[model samples]
Target: MDCDSKTFTYIWEVNLDEFDRVSNLYSPPFSSWNGSVEEPWQLQFYPHGKMSIASSCLALFIVHRKLHHVEMDYTLMLINQKDENETLSVDKHSTFENSEDGFGPGPCIDDDRLDSPPSEGIYDPDRGFLVDGKIKIGVRIPTDPIPIKRKVDNMVSFTWDLSLDRYKAVPNEEDLLSPKFQTINNGEKNTWQIQVYPNGVVPELEGFLSLFLVHRGKDAITTQFEISLVNQDPTKSYRYTMEDTFSHDLNGWGEREVIGRRYLTNNTGFVFGDNVRFEVRIPLDDVSINKLEKEQAIVPFVWEVPLADMTSPTGEYLLSPKFMTWNSDESDTWQIQLFPNGIKSEKKQFVAAYLVHRGVKKVDTSFSLFISNQNEENTETVTMENVKFKYDLHGWGANAMVKRSDLEDPEKGFLFDGKKIKIGVQLATDHIPLKKTDSVMVPYTWEVKVEDLKLGTGKYLLSPNITTWNGQNKETWQVQLYPNGLSTEDNKQVSLFIAHRGDNEVTSRWSVSVVNKDPKKTESRTGTNLFGYDLQGWGSRTFIQGSKLRDESEGFIFDGKVKIGVELPSDNITLSIDNECPVIKEAPACEKCPAVVDSPVTKATPAGNPYDSPRPSPAGNPYGSPRPSPAPINASLHNLYRELKLKTPDGSEFSINHIMSFESIEKLISNLMRLSGSSSNYQPSISSYKHID
Candidate 1:
């Protein structure tokens, strides 16, 4: 094979701002095979410089990604950003076979300097090093030029039916409920009940269906469950999940507008044989920790300066890298370019610098840029905060950062032995956007069903036998039912709630309902209500709070059992199919015969709407106010996160779900995509990324 045609290479930048934040900091290891939390090939810098048994110089090590003990060639470059075309660079290339013995350029070229003095030219500015107190570092990795055949992911689905006529029959009444509740139990011996209101009881939520999960067990067991309102027609299903720790004080969780009522009652889509199928699933496992806590942490981004790059040999004016550090927010990248050989005043002996936005749109932010001398004897520190920053493809800040007379003094420590310097940045916000560079939202059908639900007259709390996946289609959700009347201040009313497991922010729209066992009547189930607009994680509003539900005249309960359901009407997955990778994979169900599940739903509520109020308190659950329901999800790759669970080149299993940020998402994907051979039960749904506590 031709060497150039078979080898693939990728380039990235590494910032060394955290060089001095150490009581005991050293270089991190990297690998070409196994990847680490940092990157495939990692870089570490020592401010005081480093010396091997044979060489002496400022040390920057290239460690193999930890655990990745593979033989490979590596290189590190010192680039001058001043000139886009003709700047020179200092590069180091070598090969290593073990992680325990990580390698970088080191000082192999200056091995004779083992006995040199502190004033040596190896890391000194007089030798074309450290461009304006900063350096640009980059790396290249190889990949297989050939592609693999595409394959399809395993497809799983469920179906059930719901008959709505068994409940109350009141057209003009404010609220309606089942004359009796449906009781169910789980494998753990916990009991629960399901309640539904055809017409909402809340003043503003009057037109929607209101569903609830009611806990009636003796123990404080946490439950997980899934419920879906399957459409009878060939449309998508609406789904809802709950992963929760429901105790006596905090027992229930729910949502409104799981789906619209027109589809179920009038045969718009959900009605089939005058009956709509509803499903319930309680799987027997817990979602992974990465899935449970989908939100990752961001921080103070920092970069370092190598005196060798202080003067742009090409007279251009910068020495900053291209990548942002630990950036997860969809926010744009703000950069700092240092100009040692002053921009406008080359004759005035001044150091110039500018800040620019690498992103496309206009951005407003405040940052703190710290420039301090490495020498403790010199108290010279340059600090700027709350500095107004607004920039586009152009730039801002001074053309000359400081007068040459100020940073070059021998005793200043800004230059240790007149060789190196230090600098870093800290920004102030976390706002991720909806669209991304890579990843597309594909469609699929994720469904499950539960049957033989015998809601005898007595009090009962039915829960799924095992935990279920809430949003990801894994086992992360549950349902609670109250067959007997639930306790309230004045009257007896059946109650219910939909529960999900994790505590991450969830943007969802699903349907829940009471299926009328009788198919003769036309108007049967409750109308779908919307959730996540105001009350984030979990959603609930009283469908029948007052004494009106007890009326024997309304024909509330016609029987002892009513099937319930939930589904996702429009769910799009964010996936990146090269469209060129020859690997053969399973065709997405959304194509010719897609399973109708979730869809991107948008419904905003006014201040006076039931959607605006806190979930009403249950007579049994002592927690007076409503609390949020957590859903377990992979935080990174907002789309198709589960696909990242694969062993890295470092021989260790890695999961990107917890590290979903701009840096990791872009840098890790290439390696991760190559490492993964397993597929995921990926369900797609658009989220607002809001935290509804």
Candidate 2:
């Protein structure tokens, strides 16, 4: 349920004014104390709407103030603080690349080219949707790197029903200067005015009409809004719009270039029935109050350690020595290690790990181990977050730390490509008090991701090669399974084997399993034993008895393929994550850094066979080195072969010292019984295709 511990939260609050007429606006970047989208982040509000449906609903957006790239997982909300139930939100995972200036998700505006202005939302001011005359929007980011399709969004009270013709410019110069036709526009926090000079106030264009927008707010403050003018007659109802930002030396924006005397005097709707109308929109992107952000300055303390594949191999299944980190405080050290196989003593049958404290002195802290898989498709990507590895004597870990099953699953990135991998450690001290404002939680989180190289799964024709242990990739073997009985039904017997296909003797602690397909019948068998590669091929003839296999009631047969699985014991490790671990800076200081002889990448053997390696073959293993193929082996086969008592005639002939294999003895007895006309061992023959079952 919860995403791994590598997660944090960020909250953004936006307050908008003149919510009805304002098309949209963006707030100043939120300072660090509040929250940051990795950097300064601003909120964009659309009183009218956003995106495709701007005509129907109001919307909010996020904008990055800097021209850098970022990926974020966000949850945005439009909350009616007065009425908690009237909250709206959108969740999205967005990535923003560097823009010439700022990269922002717009309010229906094309950043590259403007084909049109922002579309308007259904705003009706008379319905009273504002809470204390302001709209508040909130955004929360959960995943750090991380949508509303709802019918209930049709609720009313957020728009304006008031007509645009309520206010107008007078017909004459004398009246235009009158107090009745001219007034100030009131905003939630500041005030501004529009002055119409029938007689140009500036001498340059005396005969032309002049319009000026003025901001009477504070000197250092800035305000952005939209203004429009309309000729009310049905024949001339189109309105020309202008978006404006006013502050400091720039008090307003407008000019006489807006119209010609002929266009205005034409009975010609300009003075249609003697009235001029206009609309002003000032969206509230943030609260009206000006804010002063305090300074934030503190570099986090971070440490890095490379997990080299030394001193341990995948085949070594018992616990190994712990890897130590240099102590940051010189008080206590942290220890860590991996168990390629599962830790059997604890019944933990998966890759296990731990974080332990080694020094006598302890400290208080927490850490997150990032076993990162750079491969996007890898499921083994790990972020073990917020581990409180105590400064106490012992440590915390197990094979279950990174579930063994997940490691073995190809899709799970854990070690699907067993290679040289990097394990990251992030440390964070307890809450540290600040000199000025509140305390800060300083964490040493790494910017780099988890990355690893892989050892190959060898190539083979008749057998499939698999690598069980990932460390140094030494313990690799081969295996192939026969779903149905290997031979025809008449003498059908499920077979499993360990082939001697490589150069050296392959030693394995293995398991063979056969599951009954029918849940109701529920019959199965699991056998485990130690195996050593000797002859050409070794293992069992009866991994599952043919008689018990075809029993319709309790047979092991499932679909067309009989399920046979093979597993072997891996290795173990004992380590811990100490809150006070020192950073491993040099290889010489840490004695555990093994002297490694890197193995050359083994190329797929030229088509022939792995057993055809150029190396000389050892005695009985006529093949090169005695390498074993990976297949389930029946333990009883080895024990049965040990009781051999062969009879060789005293002649100059070949060696005949061997025990009767169950299959051979059964065939001989079956023939004798058939000659006697007995029905005990009779069986119907099967097709080759069916034999593959």
Encode model 2's per-residue lDDT on 35-139: one tens digit a residue. 111244566665545455434333566765433345777666655455566455556778754321222232232222211122222122222233444545555
1-693: candidate 1 lDDT, tens digit per residue: 122332323222323344433322332332222211112345555445455434454355565422212444444444445554533333455554432354554433544342232334333434443444444444444433322122213212223333343222212123321121222234343434444444543545544555545455546765455455554422234445555666773255454534334334553455554344555444332321111012323344444577777767424666454323222212344556676767754444767555555422234444545456665444333444444443233455555455666677656556655666665455443333212211111212112222222233223333332222334543233333433223322133333444433334344323233332232211111112223321123333232322332333343333432344333222233322222211111232213121111111222111111211123213222222233322111122144331245443335554443324344444554544455642333221223112121
The parts of candidate 2 lying over 4 Å away from their true place are 1-22, 31-38, 50-53, 99-129, 143-693
TM-score of model 2 vs. true structure: 0.17
* lDDT top scorer: 1
Q: RMSD for all candidates, in order, please.
A: 37.5, 32.9
Please report, as a residue range, the 10-residue window in candidate 1 with the lowest summed lDDT: 604-613
lDDT of 2 at 274: 32
